[model samples]
Target: MHSVQNTLYVMTPNAYAHLDNATVRIEVERETKLRVPLHHIGALVCFGNVLVSPALMHRLADEGKSLVLLDNSGRFKARLEGPVSGNILLRQAQHRAALDTEFALTAARAMVAGKLRNSRSVLQRGARESADPGEAETLTSAADALAASLRAVPGAADLDTLRGIEGEAARGYFAALNLVVKPQARQSFALDGRTRRPPRDRFNALISFLYSMLMNDCRSAAESVGLDPQLGFLHAVRPGRAALALDLQEEFRSVFADRLALTLINRGQINAKDFDEREGGAVMLNDQGRRQVVTAWQERKQEEITHPLSENKMPLGLLPFVQARIFARTLRGDMQGYLPYLAK
Candidate 1:
């Protein structure tokens, strides 16, 4: 499976029969179609409108593929096999072990700071392509501020410190973005904004969408490793919060999502028509917009990049792989730390 490029995505409003083609086919639909390849599938995500065939239900229990179902609101409804059946005592110990101050702080800092720095890295790259020199300077400055915050994170005592750094970094990043997108009155991004019609102004909308995709990718990685998604290190343990998913997503929000968003904009892969402010107080991507985003995300998954810690070859698209490895090590007691993945 490692050697195989076996990620298949299907998004169809119309019904279609399942083909006996790939090992895993992620079907996201409003209703059910044919029998799902549960044994073959590695993961599945359905957003609101989906009806599962009886065979697929049975396969879920037997094959135990990474099955995750979400409601219309995108909250996790059901998971096929997310819990461990190992010795209760060992599992309890692992859970408690995870709460130690050292482990907690290390993981949280790495994720938060990684995300902030990656965002800076992406913005700087985008700045290079900005049409205006002033805009580029602002972006570079934002990137620098974010970098400084990231460097000051190792000694952060609590989540509040992490949050402060994150906030400051975002402020700088957004300040620069406003300049890049100012000429386009229809486009803008602000740190302080509500999910209104055009949930985010053109610029912010794209960034927010990119952020969502990044979070999903990180969640997928954490789920694959069988860790409790709610027991997070950085974010507070709120009810129904995918705390661990939030934690994992921290490192990726910028690394994957921001990079993709900029590429789409600079390459002319997406435009204003891709967004819709149809409803009041909320904005969203049109079907075409979602399609384009997913295509770019999938393309990102296929690209390879270097690992800063391992100093070995890994996928640029393998943010999940990198994350899963971190979790696996933490669980096995092989490593006493969780390090954020960084570029060489």
Candidate 2:
């Protein structure tokens, strides 16, 4: 049996990396050499001041490997690859399928349904954990109706109809948020429109920060796979918004973001202590909480998942591959409809 490959995680305050005589060198106070077999490296997640050599960059370019960079504050700064083949037909195919009434509706429904289902499950789990069965049943019904509505929408012509359906689906999920989180006082996100500086409350700040990172990954991956990162059926395509990424992220809202948020709250891994109340109605996470959330998120990305279409196990890392495959299937006319990935 082949061993699973480990993603190389370079965490440091400051460092320089370059190729020294064909060997990859990671230099700080002292130099360490890593003769990384290209196949052995699944991805690169760099935390703070880690440098990449031009030679190493070229090598990754040749192999088409993934590089995810995180700043000290846990902000995702850049994604290096665009993953375009420079073929006009391919680009046209992506745009056509993305905008097609039937295809877009099919893709949108699957994803929207997946998100609704997960939302219900999260509510149920949180309810059960808190010893509340009433909450669970409420969530179960929400899941049922959301699924029904997804199938019910026959032929959505534009983004509005799709969003109308999503609105219906969301009612069931949000109804349970108050039940899950205790209501000593209501916390506000106070987004003067950007997440920056000393966060108002550690918990809310952690959620936004982590969510932003996930959003970047989803958008970058969708773009690399040749999907229009800006056009999403379930989400409105506004200025600077990555709707397609939002669309692809539906199945993961529960599996990735929401679950992490709940876990952090439940495990007492993070709490009110980690947050601060800013004068401008903003909330933020302290340094310790920031580290905790980013670490957990990285581990979550490394979690292995089974591909719904391929029936082969892969990491959440391959969600992009999965996205590209389904879109390609629609273009090639192989699939009657595309289904978003839902874990059993």
Candidate 3:
């Protein structure tokens, strides 16, 4: 089992980070702000203008830790890491499996099935919890729609057909996701539909930020298990794109990122005041908002959950690594097929 470790996020503008002996120290205005042992961190993520020393970068890479940089809005900028590690034979098997159309289709189907099933679970929970009868009905209808989509997954003839089904289901799911927000906060956190690149609304901005962080974890999970993050069964291989990471993240999006976003919004932890409206109609979480979300995200990761397959409890943060290992097992023929994590 992969142990859950902290991902240090440095979002304070103009902060400088450097290696001091066996620890990483952060300084602002030439004064020490924080110092942490490097061994305790799995990854170091910097946002905006934070500077990292070359010695720290070298140490991180040597220790097999990742360094990720994102813009203030949580958009990915770059990632630095050590040389590729993991089983060469396992990666070769993964590459070959990607070329097998039947295998690819089967894996893609399972991924879509997991996504739809989890999405329906979210909607059904929302329906039961909603105070307003009309909102409850709307959520129930959407859950039913997602159920229908789940049924169609087995019938998908090819990857394109499966993708089409997933796309259609996602459209309906997002359309109904608005009801999940509390009634009083709905006016301020309205989400017409999913938007990205430059999230148009506050809700979109919040979720996009969470999704970026999730993506980084997924990518690291894939690499940790000796699977090529670039080669994927469900997503097409492309240069500079972590297709396999994206594939692994499908099962986690609604349950992890979406759920956390809703929790923060509905519970009044994050509100309209947390976001900043930029020129060109882009909305994003300001520094204070990012700190709040990051703290909540870290806390959420510490919560334990029972793995359906293993029947063992583990931290929620370790799910991606577990899933990635399962994927590697399927590629290596230890498992008949890839089994996705299903939320209860």
Ranking according to lDDT, highest score first: 3, 2, 1
Say which candidate scores most in lDDT. 3
* lDDT by residue (tens digit), candidate 3, 121-175: 9999999999999899999999999999999999999999999999999999999
Task: Summing lDDT over every window of 10 consecutive residues in candidate 2, give the lowest-scoring window.
Answer: 185-194
Q: Taking the tens digit of each residue's C-alpha lDDT, what string does model 1 give over 216-239?
A: 566666655656666777888888
For every model shown, the clashing-pair count is: 8, 11, 0
Off by over 4 Å in 1: 1-8, 14-39, 70-94, 178-198
* Residue 13 in candidate 2, Cα distance off native in Å: 4.8
lDDT tens digits by residue: candidate 2, 238-327: 976677777777777665776787666756667666665668865656555556676777767778887766778877756755765675
The collision pairs in model 1 are: 30-49, 30-50, 196-281, 196-282, 197-282, 199-283, 304-316, 305-316
- Model number with the top TM-score: 3
Estimate every model's Cα lDDT from 0 to 1. 0.61, 0.63, 0.91
Q: How accurate is candidate 3 locally (lDDT)?
A: 0.91
TM-score of each: 0.80, 0.71, 0.97
Q: Stretches of candidate 3 above 4 Å error?
A: 1-4
